[model samples]
Target: MNNYKEKQLEKSAEHYAKKVFKVIAAIVFGAIVFGLAIYVLMRLWNWLTPELWGWSTLTYWQALGLFVLAKIIFGFGGEGACKPKKGKKNKKKWKMKCDMRNDFSDWKLYDEFWTVEGEAAFKRYIENHKKRHHENEQKQS
Candidate 1:
């Protein structure tokens, strides 16, 4: 029993160590990529700006700051892409707001609604509007 427990504890510790190592590796990789991006941006700015626009070349920190500012202004990731994920309940409302494609599935029912109730609703609205306008004119007079 003691041996089994010890083995189990060791296995758990190994698993936790592997997870920690993975997280550390990911953080290191992300930092490297981030530094590389800043370096590339600085190099490109130095290569192009002084010759083309007579602008001052950016330093490493300035390039990093500019990248951060651009991200803040333009934002990150697919914001308005509107791809619905699994388990979202308000799918219809989400699609209506984000989907700009011309062939919206809901529009297919528009003709049906217009034939059934839209025309009657419009005439009723028009009549009510005219009555309100006439009443306003009379009150003004």
Candidate 2:
């Protein structure tokens, strides 16, 4: 009836209001953190640069600009920068290239490989390289 409909409408309004509050809170918190970072950066630059490098000190806006520029150039690293992706067949390949882990699981048999077949392979490569160089010299002459 009418009462049931009003209750449903109230619940929906409350849910949306909570969501909007969370969004506003997040934006405000982000702004505060950003402002604090810029202030700290400006203070540090003003303290250090004038003394060490005889460089000009930065204002808050200048510090903010520099921070943005540095982020743009060096990248804005965030969460999961090195975290492995799920359901990925290339996780091993990605981990191999990531700087997070120095593990060489595949290279565990490197010594055995070198002892068994690496020397012969290297010698063959050297012989091939020498032949190629000699052929190039002959061609040039």
Candidate 3:
């Protein structure tokens, strides 16, 4: 029983070591690629800036810093492109909202009608609404 436990522990330790090594290798590789990218950006800046705008040629570190600065200011990977994950519930909600806005006229409300809560409200109204013509007939009777 003790021998079996020892083998299991050795296997687990080897697995853990492999995972750590892989993580370290990925980090090193990422750093190398980032360094190369920075160098490329620096070369392009050097080639263009001094000739076009009378700007001084940047050093390696300056170029890296500029890259970092641009990334910070302009940003990378903005949330503007994010799409909500579609699900059956969302589809149902969209249909409900569409039904509720049968007489949509306002442009601002049109935008609001497409939102989740507005869609929900639209759905609720659709489900509960008594036909206006039906109510009128009963009133006349």
Candidate 4:
């Protein structure tokens, strides 16, 4: 293969590796968080309701299995309760003109903005937006 083709293949492999790493990292992180939450919940339950802890005891493996079963049932709404759909739906249909535009160019504007004044400006912008959002939510409530 030509040098250009070889370089393209190398970059493609790198991109694929990066995407796979991201997916694996997300799964591992999610598992850790879920385990931690379960542990905390069990500790809290034992602390708050000592009587329940003595009624019947489950081993670590049994507790883990029960937790998984409970998650599958409640998380997926096995009892037919009202369950919100996961993930956002793309509602707005873009026109062909909008589709034709380069997405990188839009991203470049933010890149240029941050580059001009360093990250402080971007950080301030995020903080201001967060504050505004909080205020708006408070007003709505």
Q: Write candidate 2's Cα lDDT for 29-58 as tens digits.
A: 999999999999999999999999999999
Give the distance in Å from residue 6's predicted Cα in candidate 3 to where it truly belongs.
1.5
TM-score of 1: 0.63
Model-by-model lDDT, in order? 0.92, 0.90, 0.82, 0.71
Candidate 3 at residue 123, lDDT? Answer: 80
TM-score of each: 0.63, 0.68, 0.55, 0.45
Better of 2 and 3 by TM-score: 2
Reference-based TM-score, model 4: 0.45
lDDT of candidate 3 over 14-129, digit per residue (tens): 99999999999999999999999999999999999999999999999999899889999987854332333454456666656666765456666767667947788878787667
Model 4 gets an lDDT of: 0.71
lDDT digits (tens) for residues 11-53 of candidate 4: 9999999999999999999999978877776666555555855
Q: After superposition, how far is residue 140 of candidate 2 from its true place, in Å?
A: 3.6
Model 1 ranges off by over 4 Å: 78-81, 84-96, 101-141
Instruction: Kindly list the per-residue Cα lDDT of model 1 for residues 42-109, writing each as its tens digit.
Output: 99999999999999989999999999999899887674557777787899977886766645799899
Model 3 scores a C-alpha lDDT of 0.82
